[model samples]
Target: MQDAVYGVVSNYYQNKVKGNHEVGLIAVVHTFGSDLKWNPHIHALFTEGEIDKNNKWFKKISHIPYKYLRKSWQKLLLDIIKKNFTDIRTKRLINKLYKTHNEGFYVNAERDIINIKQASKYIGRYLARPAIAEYRITN
Candidate 1:
């Protein structure tokens, strides 16, 4: 699935893309849901500019096809898992995966990252903070 995410981004960035320069972004993998449940998802942080053929930075992408990105990621993950697991026991697991795949997957892209000011502040508070915050305390 990791490779799938990377491939989806890389393919779009490398091919079928124009105008913007080739840019690199960071992908973060989170396997838990918002309510602390078991839901696997990925958060992709993409740069606005692309690294051009000449290695220059271009402006960010204005319009992104989020649905296409989601489908591409889904297809990649399923393809890899099917290839790696050919055993019977794993077959059942694969079946379950397929069933869940019907529900579809999610891919979010942040296009308006003009500067790193807000991100830097977030990091400072995130890293300096503890696992549980005061808000989690109950009466």
Candidate 2:
């Protein structure tokens, strides 16, 4: 799951950011939401740019193309799933998902990181956050 997140972002950045294969990023998988609901998802914090062949960081990226990435992610996920599970039923479901979700899977990036404070807050909340908050536990 982690690799897939990195792969998609790396591929997109490489293609869009002038063929730079290197992408600086940190991806975290959060398996549960507040209230202890079983919700699994990945969050990534990536640099807008990276070092090019000239060994210079090209920090020109401003926005991400979520629409296109969604399609790529969907394909990647389905392929991964298909490879892991070869059962006919699973295959059928995979095919169904592909056909149904034309725009591909929905992956969300932290859009509110407008400043260092907000960014740090997000990192604290997601990246380094414990499975259960200290206050949530009681003896």
Candidate 3:
């Protein structure tokens, strides 16, 4: 799954990049959710603009078509998962995977923030830090 995202995003820039435009990608693959849920996702830190093969700067893409990206990611994910498990006829759990094929996946790309320092500060607080994480149960 992680590889699929890396493939799609990397390919998009590598192929779509024109003239001297290049883009560096930094992506992180996360498997769990905020409330300790099993929602898998990826977070990418992309530069605002493209850097040329000769190290020249170019204007960033004006608008990121998130819906298009999401659709692409979902297809890639489905293809990858399908290759691994192919017992849909016998395995009940495996069959459920295809059931959600029509539902489509999600890809959330945040707005490009120009301020690096402010973004780091935001991430420092927003990214989870561990501990005191005891689950309370009442009987």
Candidate 4:
């Protein structure tokens, strides 16, 4: 899952930045959501734009390609699944998913993080949060 998030975001930035230059990011895997169910997902904080090989930022992106990202992320994840498992049923299911989700999987991001402080806080909030708050867990 971590690899999936990193791969999808890296691909997006690499295409945008147009170089082998690195894309900085930190991805945290959460096996549960706010409700504490076994809902697996990733929370990632990364640079909006990347530096080029010549040590120059190509541009400051105010927005990301959401549509492109959704499709790419879906494809990559399905590919990963396919690679990991060689079962016929799994392949059939993956094929069906490709045809079914024409618009691709859902991918969301904040419109803008504004600054490192905000981004740090946002990621930290999720990382440090408890599955069940202490007050709620009290008997």
Candidate 5:
């Protein structure tokens, strides 16, 4: 799952984001949700834009559309799973999921950091945190 997420994201940025330019990304994998359940997801911190072959970085003023991202993510995930698993039942299940979700998989670009400091802080917070904090647990 982690590999799939990284692959799809990189592909999206490389191909769709800004033509054929390269994009930098830092992916963090979270295997558990706030409820301490197995909810695998990727927290990827990426450059605001892409870097050209001339070694110049270009900052994008606009964000990628969520709809397009979601669909692309879904397709990539399914393709990865299909390549990895050859079981007919699993393949059928994946196909069913693809068919059931018209909007594709969820790919959210939650928040954007305005500067390098903010980006560093955001990364630090997530990296330093645990799967579920003790403060969030209540009876």
Candidate 6:
């Protein structure tokens, strides 16, 4: 699952975010949400832009259409799952999900980070946090 997510995201950035270029990024997989549910997701921190084949870094365009990202992500994720699991029931379920959700899966690219220090702090707190913090658990 982790590999699939990373591969899809990298491909999305390379092909969609910046054509003919690759983007550097770090993806942290979070298997559980704050409520301690078995909800898997990824937190990826991408470079402000992309690096072309010429080894030149280019800042990404200001606008990245959320709709495109969502649709692309949904397609890629479903493809990955279908390729890995070939069972009849699984394939049916995936197809049903695809037909059910026209907008695709949820892929949100949060606000940009202007400060490196602040970004680092935020990443550390989010990616390194425990699955279920004792403080967050009520008695």
Give the best candidate by TM-score: 4
> How many clashes show up per model?
7, 0, 0, 0, 0, 0
Candidate 2: regions farther than 4 A off: 112-114
Residue 77 shift from truth in candidate 1, angstroms: 1.5
Each model's C-alpha lDDT?
Answer: 0.65, 0.80, 0.63, 0.80, 0.76, 0.76
Q: What's the CA RMSD of model 4 in angstroms? A: 2.0
Superposed Cα deviation of residue 26, candidate 6 (Å): 1.2
Estimated TM-score per prediction? 0.65, 0.84, 0.66, 0.86, 0.80, 0.81
lDDT tens readout by residue for model 3, 15-91? 56666565656565656766767766666666656787687887646455776576677778767666776776534
Off by over 4 Å in 5: 6-10, 13-20, 132-139
Minimal lDDT window, size 10, model 5: 11-20
Report lDDT (Cα) of residue 139, candidate 1: 75
Model 5, global lDDT: 0.76
**Residue-level lDDT tens digits of model 1 in 56-122:** 7765455558776767777788678779988888778767776887644566555555568966654
Please report how far candidate 3 places residue 73 from its true position, in Å: 0.8
Query: What is the model-wide C-alpha lDDT for candidate 4?
Result: 0.80
Q: Return whichever of 1 and 6 wins on lDDT.
A: 6
Q: Model 3: which ten-residue window has the lowest total lDDT?
A: 129-138
User: Candidate 3 — which residues are off by over 4 angstroms?
Assistant: 14-16, 19-21, 86-103, 122-139
TM-score of 2: 0.84
lDDT score, residue 23, model 2?
Answer: 74
Which scores better on TM-score, 2 or 6?
Answer: 2
lDDT of 2 at 82: 97
- Could you give me the TM-score of model 6 versus the true structure? 0.81
How many angstroms is residue 69 displaced in model 1 relative to the true structure, after the best TM-score fit?
A: 1.0
- The CA lDDT at 102 in model 6 is 83
Best model per lDDT:
2
For residue 109, model 1's alpha carbon misses the true position, in angstroms, by: 4.1
